[model samples]
Target: MNIYKIFLLISLLFNTLVLQAKEEKISIQLDWLHQFQFAGYYIAKEKGYFKEENLDVIIKEFDFDVDLVNGVLNSKASYAVGKSSLIIDRLEGKKVVLLAAIYQNSPMVLISLNNSNIKKIKDLKDKKVMLTPDARSAAAINSMIISQGLNLKDINFQQHSFKLEDLISGKTDAMGCYLSNEPYILDSKNIEFKIHNPSEYGFEFYGGLFFTSQEELRQNPIRVRKMHRAVLKGWKYAFENIDETVKIIYEKYNTQNKSLEALKYEAKILKELAQFEEGNLGNIDYKKVEEIKRLYLLLGLSDSAINFKLEDIIYNPKKINLTQEEKKYIRNYQINLISNSNFPPFTIETDNKLSGIEIDYWNLVRKKLNLISAIEVINNNQEANEKINTNANNLKYAFGTADYENINSNMSMSVDKVKLALTTLVDKPYTTAITELANKKIAITKYASYYKDLKKKYPKINFVETASINESFDLLQENKVYGILGKLPALSYNITKKTISNAKISGIYNENYELRLHVNKENRVLLNILNKAISTITDEERKLIRDKYNSIIYEPEKDYSWVYKIITFLSVLIIIVVINNRKLNKEIKKRKLAEEELNKIAHIDGLTNAFSRRKIESILELELNREKRYNRGLSLIFFDVDNFKLINDQLGHSTGDNVLEKISSLVNNTMRKTDSFGRWGGEEFIIILPETNKVQAKNIAYLLKEKIANFDFEIDRKVTCSFGVSQFEETDCADSLLTRADNAMYYVKRNGKNEVKVV
Candidate 1:
């Protein structure tokens, strides 16, 4: 062999080693001692998901005094895992943002012997109740009591030494134990026990939260997205291969010296706590998160005002890889998606046509999959689940929450999740905590799986079980009940629609409940195909659905309604205005008629050619009186050019004035006589809609967004507007209505521009 050839091979090997060294290095800091709870990160690292993303991840196990938050804050680690304490830190205005939820349902429960008189939380009064100071269980117990209108003073609190012997000896009335921990020992010894879960009584909480600093998330979003995807993929792998995961935890990751049986038991309960069996693991529940905020406020963890937003913690998942077989399956198959009408922000039905987040998401899937699709709208969860469960060969898939348990596990799979909450009248609000609603009347259609135990526990509450969700809201509106019960994006949809007013969430429900993309159990090929498609839906795409439907903002080119009534009216109005002006101009040219020009100036805006301030105000006055007489909904939108002052400062005032004129022309054409569009003030515009609620008004605002955005401006080119939307109340005057709209608009301005907000 040639010496030159040998040298070339050696150089090639060295270059390969150098390329491998270039992988982006990062470290994860874990809170608490090493255990199976942190097994997902270990699995991700071992399986090369991090390597596949060109990342070199370092795992840093934590000790008691390490301060997991400071690790990310001071850059000791790129990311970390912490418990409920992280929520307290965030609500206290900490700099970290939670990335994902590791445990969807908290494991903390009050374990007591069935022989004891303490059955309900109320029964625990004057009895020895164990409090584990170091764990979230104590917090959970306190939360449970306060939520039911009881305080810690009512209970006989005992400081636990983390021993099971006292509780087993019946020396203590009850012990706070993780369902996976000491409870397992009791089960092994055949000790009968009754568990009191705080979550079942409306103390639902997120256990383990993954986090990073706001700066790190923003500065390294690509890194965040990559790590988030890999970690989630790792969780999926761990749950699917439980034995392997348990073996890894027992042999490799365990520092507690947990036996294989104990490790396996831990793994099983972790899956239960995380709701891994139901699916859509590692995602945060935005609704429950809001409840956590409220719970903390109730628990005195936060002050009266909450400074942090849920968006501060929640994140979108990045797409993962797909196989060729899965790709081929989607391309060749005709898939049918299960959806229900009136489910806004998810599934929407307007004028016999479908739109909203689900449509947008599935449409994207259809385009990518190259599949012909059909929407099967089963308005009821029970029916949808039954069809999919009993008739799996015919009915392929549907959307459901695990709380429903409507989908029989024999034939269904939960591919995703969503949060369910109860809506109550803000003016006459009721307590959401189950036991507190003892005698109060509340409305609900069908109870989810979580409700069965609640019903058995709180029987005194007068439940106005309705035939359907629509009826539930009707009951609330008629004052037949104190509150209405349902979940989002349905609850949010109805609220946005203004079908229910003066309503706020008094209670949020479901522990480990998720939006699942359930497929037929028998259809393995199709299941694999859809699972891959859902997994690969990118963060940007998810945001497009999750965020878009909430606002209902659509691009100008996307036409929702079939009727071109708006187009026809605008064309005729333009033609009439043009012909009259042209004729008027000829007469003025002949007779020098200054009077006609003066009349035009009086009625028309000089800068925008839209209705002048006086004309629009007169229209608003008439609409207000008419609305008062008929007793119907009337809404208004206030909007303004986002950077008008900037444009005027940079360009001449002429360009700025022309921008207002152009925006007016675009918006004026989209109006009905029932609606009025005018310049409210300099750079601000007002839209009045008679017989329109906040929901319908939002539709109008969304429709006009893209046109204004894409308007062809020659100089000082940027054109965007912030909008505030509101509907009239019975006691509302024109001033009050306008004020609400103004406030809503300012909220948009303060947060971010070029969006719509409703009040």
Candidate 2:
């Protein structure tokens, strides 16, 4: 061999090395600049997780509407951090599909000063709130406002610059903030703040998702999956050893004052914030994606959108290997059939078939269990419910009806309340001035829990009973009754042009009812699956599905121009008539003014112009109604100023009011719209929180207590509130609820004022 042969061999080996390096270069674009929020990607890079996967990954920072999704679609990048809004973007024909969600819950929140007297999402109504012009925060706030029965136009918005200045200066009641960022700033500034996280209130959407083009998902799914696994490993490492990851981030960015301690704290927060349970880190909930899509549609954010089904968006968890015996057990188990009606939508009928959410859910359960049999649907609620009760041997496993009360004795049943919009209206003549119909019969399904209150409220009126909601609507149209109560969607469907057109909806009843699947005593296996399925279907998913098809039928506006002109003409013609009605008009105006004053007083805190004790009580009552009616859960917290007498003694009487007013304002500012804050007594306050359990309530209470203790009251005086929380129980009376909360508060008092106690 000569020198020329050695040179040729060396050149070939060098070329092969270059080709392998080219294949390994992978660039990923993130949705935003680097932070703990993107720690997983950073950790993966730093810890050699990506390197182990034989990948050289470059993570690019996205800025100023730079669509990384478009980069993926165009093959410029392999993957990117996709915002929850990416679902909306995809629906609108963008070529990106979410691969995984970094956060299980959305981190976007509405933050307010510790003294703005604005708490909860509902409090933003008719109030000024600051918003970022182009973020998911705006969409979330809008959706929240709409859900509270208020329109976007009802509230005023100031443009926010991602700072706490507007809130600090009291220019805006609340400012949009991320739970991981702005809250830390507020804490560092020693400024107390309240945060309203939309995710907690059913405004469900994914955040910080890993996304790629559908084409990429199809072409290189294995590579995509490998990336996901590595990303997850990185997240686990970062979560477990946050200090090291924070140091890496600080060193990489040359952030000298990054405060590794704060970064570690933020990491711990992110661990809870990110989706760590369902799959590894960065797994997107398909159901949540579908919900976000529906929200986008409702918000009118997209046009000519493709319908993305739940199956299309979610990344299914990796398949787990199972033994043959386990597979057989899953395959052979028979799900009981309970309900009868076979109602379309809830229970679809196609080619004499039956399928819907219930069917789909049960099927998923069977698939998960490796079961082969299908869940059977019965014809009527009575037959199914009755059969299950009467003969244990008839069908040990049956899916039937169960109300809140049905969960009592005699029969063992698992109840899942499906939230739906329901409304009712009396005939025009009857609604206006018909006395005879005041006592006339109104129809509702007999076993339905919604009827219990209506019947109790109007005991004197004749109650018309029906077997099903459809029959009740029919009876109303046939003049057999004065009013009909039914689900809002079904009622709206019946009054559509293709259906009955003569009927008109005049009134809406705010009743949230549970539609449950009752199981017989002997069928524990089927009941367990049913319970699991219900728990899996989150409140946000239910709301999204309900709002998706429940079309809003706007009534044609009345053309009152001619009528106004005629009335004006008549007014001129009948000067004497006008003179005679002057006193009446004055009285009416006075009454209107009085009513306005009363309404204001009802909502305002009498001692501090925040919210009154009555207002908080009313809110708690309403929340209780909503919880029971919807079969959801909530927490009520009672808080009292610890050693309030000390403050009064040190600062005089007027100073006490000022202190009270300051604390009252702080409490009001700290609560979410879903939370109601009111002064319960001289120095005691109550917070009524909807859709919150004891644990969340405790966390919120702790934060509040800490804020109150650290807050500056302008006079160098310090104050703190002791919190006592009680979760709403099924059969709990209002007094019992108060007593339990009082007990918890006393326990908090004994422990120390600046503490949270839960009952």
Candidate 3:
């Protein structure tokens, strides 16, 4: 080798050694087995972001025996990834800094079958519930029950089996499931289920939090920042390129055996949950942390958690400012904000103009953030629910999204600022105790917060649902319902206008009336700006806004003009009624005469009215019953027109019918008042004798046959019938007697036309 080339090779070799030496080794303790829940980390490793940052990061699954907090604290794991609130850890002196949030919206949800009546978190009392062993998820569950004035002791807790079979097999009534996990299994199988999200009821918590001990941040800040940067980059890539990331995960890092499709779905859901698509990739908001802590403290209110502030849980805080790219993305971009049209103070619409405390507050927030906004008012709870379900930020700030956006995956920042009360008639006043609501039919708006959840919580109350609070108020006024459940503004507004002086605001449910701002997971770039704007809201400003709306009196104009108008209308109605009565009397008289004629027509057969078949049968049955009781003789002479089928087929039914009519007239002429005669059916007739022997009936039948045979029928020239005389038998019933008479008639027809046969 030449001297210059050797020097260049030696320098290149040294540089390569130095680059290799610079790579730092770190291990992240993930909460569960390998899955797309950790897709960002997997993507970072696979896509070489960690390598780019000179990191030789080792990803480890959490062992069942591992203490999650101690793992990082004791250096068993350099960092830990978990889905929980870290308030407990910070209070316990673990001194962990939350580096970045993996999922902005927690994927944890309490899931039940579609048919299950359990609708809300409060409904979980006395029901079987399965929870993950993790403290964070369990703690949230406990907090929920506590919020409902119940304890964890009231619930039947089942240990999670880490498989959906426990839930599918009915071992658990409700199971804590990840939106990215068990729900996907149900969805893939097209099984319907209901997801009970805590955030929906104002118990908002975080999910997939990435953190390390404060010592890690203090000693190796560069490496910590690198790790945070790399993980966030991985999440961004995983969310944006979902398909490609799923391929990388499934083909390489999959230990949970999650299908590529499932991973893809998980990625799509995480984008909304983590707000990666919403441009909130790994951006930590300390205000959200504070909100979580405040809620937890309120739920448990333990002394340890009380000492911890929002900053204690977050490592290094970044100021609320957007980059040029962020500014350009949001500038002049009017946020599609949704609110309630009828909800007062927080949200109200007057003459199509939406102005309320919430609106005023959000407007101020918008001005601070330098963004324009368009407000959408949800008219009812249904609209409120559906409005927020979008991936877009709703005023409730909870979002519903498209199918591909993944349900239960939207970042939520709860503004826990409202309350609700139950109103009842003053005569039927109720106490606030849930138990006291037993046997009462409480009228609630169908669109009430956590409506299904309310159903689950208070199974005792028979809920009469109304579309609006006004409808519930009407129901309450009529004494049709025992009580009404609504916000203070709604209840107060409704009761004051119902001038009957019968209704009063009664019991109040201490539920979290927190309003939330829901941003689409795909459009979370403006969340920080919004949060910064929210932070500027003074306590005085909040009180001022609320007080103004609360004190506004809605005095319904009680003009008695309506009463005078009603009296005038009633007088006119009475005059019309009097004239109608006279006309009705005359109509009634005419109707009675027409009814008499109708009765006569009904009994007489139109074609051949020889007492009618129905009348003859009535006479025969009465005579037979009398014969059985008194031992009196009774006889029936049944006959059919000889060769009737041949006559109809050869001569046409019109001619056949004309011949039968002539025969019936001849038989009627010969009948006695003591006897009854009628057409049995087409081409057939029957005679009933009240007190006659078989021989006597035979003679009568022969006479009738002879008359029919000689009678002229216009079309057939002559008409005759074969006769069968049958006496009532001791054992004969209606059907048996008819059969015997029919057999004798057949015999007569077999012998010859116009002949008599007795049986």
Candidate 4:
């Protein structure tokens, strides 16, 4: 070969080396030991999903001594799996942006044996409880205890042994465990245990928070977006082919030395926890983050009274796939915004800077679309209108404008609809009826579009013109007018702000209009982009924004010690009279009456407080007779706990009884008033739905099944029920009706528990 040929070969090799070097290298630090919990990351690496994005990914297992978050913050890792504690981490000045929420429900729960007597959160008060080091950062678990009025000091806390044997051998009465991990081990060993999940008592938290540093996101947005998409895709694949994912994890990534069966069990539970069935794999819900923030604030885990913008922590996934041309436009064009500063709460101008719901809304839209230009706040609506009319192409957007009226007018979707209401003094005899405002003087803003129409419709009403909403409210508050016609949000804000304490929203005007950002007809791309961004805003985000502006900060209550002291003295005097035998005959008579009351309630179940089996049977018989006469539809739902026998055998009969009572209470509360529910037998219950068909009855059964499936039973053990529905047929007898329902229930049990079947 010639020297030139050798040089060409070297050149080809050098080009390959450069392309390989271009593959961005990044590491993701796991929060725990290698398990199926990090299956997504593992699968992403193994399946070349990360490689597809030109990423050289490194998956790091958790360390006992190192801080997972600090690893990412210090640039040791580009990303990490965090718990809800990242919210506190952010509030505490750590710059962490939550990328995706893999686990819709956190698997953290308090676990104990049947003999531990720690059935509920309150039962753990004085027990020896073991908590892992990370448990301190588990906000939901702590809030669950605190919400039950128990302090951490109440328990003899111990460090986690991280051994199932410790719990089995009674080394600890209770311990913080993952719902996906420890419970599976006990199930394999045939050991009975209980779980105390925080979500059962309303402390729902997101687990497996995929996050990165804010700096990382800012510096490499495209990289971050690619990583997010790949990771979620991995999770979707992992759940869809669980057996295959389990085989890979057991064969390659199982650092915890987990058996294939154990790994498979963990995968199943984690899949459910991930809400894979609901789709949108790794989607972060802003409302859930809001609740977590509220919990953190309420628990004093973070700074109090802080106006934490949830969007600051949440990574807004790209909602609209922009074309190359559209992207180029967004990169080049600037937003010339004409905001209505006069609109309170919607748009507020102070210190030459505009702020309010609409302004914040646009900011979110601009950020989501990755627009290059900032919102240029013009002076006033008139100036904005004049600019748009003269230079429509230059002035791209304007707020406080009427809905599309001209051929040149184009608008993005409305951020919110403007609902009008009449505000008056609380003492006024005004209702939601517009007729009540007839023949009365009402104050309204002169600029209102409905002004002329309202005047024409209510001819008897005397209309008073005002320049602004504040002026109209002032007239009503000052008693110069019977009521003020204004926007609902403005009125609500004023009332909540205590600007006019005695005023109330008496009636809502029928005419409502949309409050949208009017885009110039010339900028159709901008309109489409704005519409997409607006569409991506969740209802929860909108509500949070509205709440931020109209939040009611309650004033401190006046001390009432004097009144309390008087009541205390009277109560003590009454107690002394009763204890001193001043009403001995009355007490005896009261005890006899209580006995009679107890006897009268024999028809009620002793444990669940539902109707007794005999009473339910009698009622069912009467219902069948009524169905025969009236020919009205009637149905019955028969159901029972899935693993109730195992619960009794492992957790003891006492815990089992508690589970039964909880199930009954949940079903009773969920049943309609016309429905008669009762305990049929051990772990079994029945409901009679009168005047209902099979489809309607099936719907009710599914609703009850969901309620039970979502409920946290004694010790947080997941309790599921198989439901059977049967409608009354003209030829059906009582036994035949029950048998059909029973057979259908057996079918659900034979197929899979926690499902509904109707026949």
Candidate 5:
């Protein structure tokens, strides 16, 4: 052979060998230990789904203290099946980016044997439940309990080893279990069980998400895409061919105990849950992202870290495809507020009437400024912070006697003094008693700057950090601490006419701190409008509202022995009666009557004789349930008084109430006999148009808003209503349908409250 021909043959042979040697390798870290929950991944591995893709995938099970994303970041793994929230936390901590969510809803659930007879959520009251170590399921279960109006103390939670045997042996009435794992095991054993899905009870969280380091995403885009596609394909295959998948799982894991029947059932359940219609199989809905964020806030996971826009969190595998209209709408849009409620006098009751000084002041500001905006009066600082941080439109603003520390970037001495005074009032009354709060066993919210400073100054005080002002106050009321420190206005607002009468402002350590509005950065224009309005209002006018609503100043009285004796005696007597009766008949009767009255009061909005949220929930629940049962058409029409918050922020809650009442009355008067109406929540109200579809509902909602807008309220001004309408879906539940209606109302509020949006 010639020399050139020999060289060509050698080069071709070397290239062929290199190609054969290159088998693609991928690694996935599971969130927990090897279990049936991850059987699909194991099955895929053993069944050659990955091999078919020219990939060799390794499954790494995480033990305690093993950071999955850190492994991914360090290149030990390419992907992870963990929580989306954890992914978000990692992203915020600059650790990882989530690619897809393996489970659309969390598998964490409260499990009880059928024999336990724990039927409803209420049945868990006073029952001992087992919790796992550092379990996310525990938080979810607790949150579900709270949403159902039961406090954590209502249930006896005992920590248990991560074993179902404790529950089976009757050591605990119920135990936390993954719906995908333990339930399947129990079913395979023919052990009947009752499972409470947290998602169904409002503790919705996305679980089993596939996340990777940002560096990995950027460095090997093809690998990332291939891995996502392969995993999804594996999931699809496992779900469709369960028998084969179970065989594969058994071969790979060497597990003969879990039956094919159970594996098949679990695979089917996971497949239905993994379905996310947008982007891809594991794609997250940004709205659901916000919902989770709201849940975190409610759960006290972390202080609203960074306010994220919808676009920021949402991942599109096919990146940045936007139409002209979408681009324009998204770019100019403001963040939406998660929910709305009255802020003052104190938090508005279901009656929708203002009763405090802050409400009065806000009302005056609105009237004098001639401004319009929807204003929700939040009752506590934590709620205010969460609302301000999460509001998509950034329309939500915190107005009070705010501390300089709350609004300013840095803490000056004056700000510190103000914070101290505020803290004195809100926190347990502390004597110049301790130099270090660490020694005092004081529990404060983790992210509260004031508490952080207190810890720094008085490290000796035993500071217990909680998640929110409400929790902090709850701790204080329990006498867990000497006191709390806070800003003056919020402190003053919180202490008025509530329990905690023994609490008082120990001293005004700082007087120079003036209350200011904490406007979200995105809503700077709205802030400017507010500032201008504040500038125009005279000091006397401000004082009038302040005096009217916040006039009842609290002062701790000297303890008297006789008074204490009488109070103690009364308390003992009440306790005896309560324990003996156990029925809570009077309490239940009072609550039922209160609910009925609230319904009536809601029907005629307290301010304008319009419907209220209480009414809305009641009417909508009935109508929606009826619609579902009968397969009849029903539509929800949402209406909001335009610039309602602006009115509250500018005028005061009193004036806002006036505007609401006025608009509400007009709506009630304008409504047709067939229209069923009630307050949606906060500034929004809904009219359930039974036997009507989307088109008719849209027309009705708009007409009501228009009529209210054009009505001559003669209450020294003009106000308008915004409308949103949606027809009930076949799959719609109470909360989901309301959320859709709320989204529609938000659409109108965003576009201009006087208009109507149909979805």
Candidate 6:
């Protein structure tokens, strides 16, 4: 206890106290009751990873009333574990920010027994389905059901009791269960069951996401990034050493009283969901998140029409991993930017300056990569290719031209995919199905890279060549071609414009359009620089650029002087003819007006714009004769709006009329061009499905039911329809066929509405 020794002891004690006081305390809310699902948080705390980052972490287990999102938003917790529904929450104006996606694919699925006979999603239709109240509106479960051609309103949904015995006791035919927890229990009991995963139906979603409020991220970004890093590290360690993690969880964090073997099984399945074998832990793909957002919109889960920026939703604190040589290349070398001027919505030459999405992206890339460049507008891809091949003007690094396939062996392309779409007029006898394009005329721009390949693949297709997309559209408008094939972005751009009315995107081109940044392979550093630049450009920026240019009307400059001169000549000639035969002209005009009015009244329904009853009868007669002569399958779907009179009484007749018009428009847009849709009478419609049988027609009816049930009508009213399907028999005439369809429809109406019945 000498004076000097006592002072040294006091100094060490003071430093220790300071270190302890500086450690920041934070808590994370789990999404469900404590189990191995939150094992990463437990491991991070146990292994002192959070402590190493100067974080004092508290793990909050979920309860029946715990709101995971609100817990974080209201500052009750610093972070939270959530599922894909966070996407809908964010779109609905929640300030939640995602830090990491622990599970690549969600474990949420509908489970049933082998003996329950609920094998497919449609089988659960009228069966007692149990779901947790929280999961009733979950994006993964609901989207799968809707995507499988079943309406949510049609299913018999029961509140989940969260007990496995209920399902075993035949109290519930199917239950929304977790693949990680419930499946392990059923397997232990040797229960033979079937899994209906949303992924199987193309509704894959991320699971076990770590998220925090934007306020926390904005106020303490460094701490947030450190916490994110530590959590990912903990996950990596947990998956690699599953036995040790399971032992730790069973000892300390097993709030659910899980057995050792059960925890081990959970960890095994979680490892697969984590996708750690790919060696990229906690990595989120922008494209995947964008798709989930779109699915939410499609499922009517998101209330707002505003688009959420994926960059804002996903957290990426790391900078571009560029090598020193690539960095130096970016600083020293100036890029030679070549663009195709005729590529609408991507590149366009206006006032000798190229403007479009490509230019906008280049500007952002330039600012991010810190590269100096100038854009050169080359109207033709052929000229751009020649310049790129020859390295004209001794250019060292050039990029941003569309035609990059096999142009030069020394050139390399960026790792981004682009696609083209087939578009056709909606009213014409053309469809989006590629198999039906045989012997049909399709217009495509000349010098397109896939033109030769398409011609070689489908020799029977007559691909009409045009100088540009504008010319192709001209051909389409004049009814000279069945459809037009062009860049997908261009087609999307035209849809918002009045340039092409009543046009629909039929299908995507089979061959991928190889449109990417082309750099000389010899310049590897430059190639790396370009790749890094493109990868770092966020989807939000791309969307903003697309929206800006897609709104622009990009009709090519045309000389209308010759057309005016022709009109003037015709006007003079018409004047002379009118003067010569005034009385005869008046009589001809009167007769023509009468004939036009009669044609419109006879052929088209005044309210819904569908074909009139007489016209539909004529069409049905023609289709029946065709089927008889050719011996092909033919079926009809007779349907009408359910509770039509009630809607008219409650919402007024105008609202009812609007519903009919919308239904007509929806059917007209979705059905195949060859299939004829017409208004049979008030609140009734018929579809003539040529070459389709009863089962196929019933499937179509189911699709219509799902669509109409989900469509958002005015006054927040849900609209549904009753459908009846019937196939023509060998001895059946047109009248007999109609009678059968009509009878089946009435049967559906008699029994509950909003269902399809086949006869």
TM-score of each: 0.40, 0.42, 0.40, 0.44, 0.43, 0.43
Better of 4 and 6 by lDDT: 4
Residue 461, candidate 4: how far off, in angstroms?
A: 90
The TM-score, computed over Cα atoms with residue i paired to residue i, of candidate 5 is 0.43
RMSD values for the candidates in order, in angstroms, are: 28.0, 31.6, 36.8, 26.9, 34.4, 24.0
Residue by residue across 298-319, what tens digits does model 3's lDDT show?
A: 5664457436656656765332
Q: Between 2 and 5, whose TM-score is larger?
A: 5
Q: Name the weakest run of 10 consecutive residues (lDDT summed) in model 1.
A: 551-560
lDDT of 1 by residue, 1-759 (tens): 799879765754553353243578999987645767777898999999999767899988765556677778888787988766666667666778887888877777888888786766677777887764435323465676665556667777776655678888877998877777777788888988888886554345677678888877656555677788899888889888989988887878877677788877878898988988777477786755665665576558555364776776676544323456766766677677777674565677878888876677667756655666788888876777677676543343333223234443322223335555667766644344556667888776664433444456668978777766778888887889987656546666677677444666665555334354565557676655454456556766766666654432112323445558877888999999999799778976866567767878887887887777888888888888998899767899999889889999999898888888888987876665457887777999899888676765775686566558866877746688999999989888888999999999999889978889989
- lDDT (0 to 1) per candidate: 0.70, 0.65, 0.70, 0.78, 0.60, 0.76
Candidate 2 error regions (>4 Å): 2-24, 71-78, 125-134, 137-140, 153-160, 170-172, 219-223, 254-257, 275-280, 295-305, 315-759
Q: Write the per-residue lDDT of candidate 4 for residues 598-712, one digit (tens) a residue.
A: 8658678898888888889999999999999998689999998998899889889999988888888877765655889988887788999887767657756876787778777
Question: Predictions ranked by TM-score, top down?
Answer: 4, 5, 6, 2, 3, 1
Rank the models by lDDT, top first.
4, 6, 1, 3, 2, 5
Q: What is the lDDT of candidate 2?
A: 0.65
Model 4 stretches astray by more than 4 angstroms: 1-21, 303-306, 319-759
- Which regions in candidate 1 have their CA more than 4 angstroms from the true location? 1-27, 31-33, 54-62, 113-118, 122-140, 153-175, 304-306, 318-759
CA error at residue 345 for candidate 3, angstroms: 60
For lDDT, the strongest prediction is 4
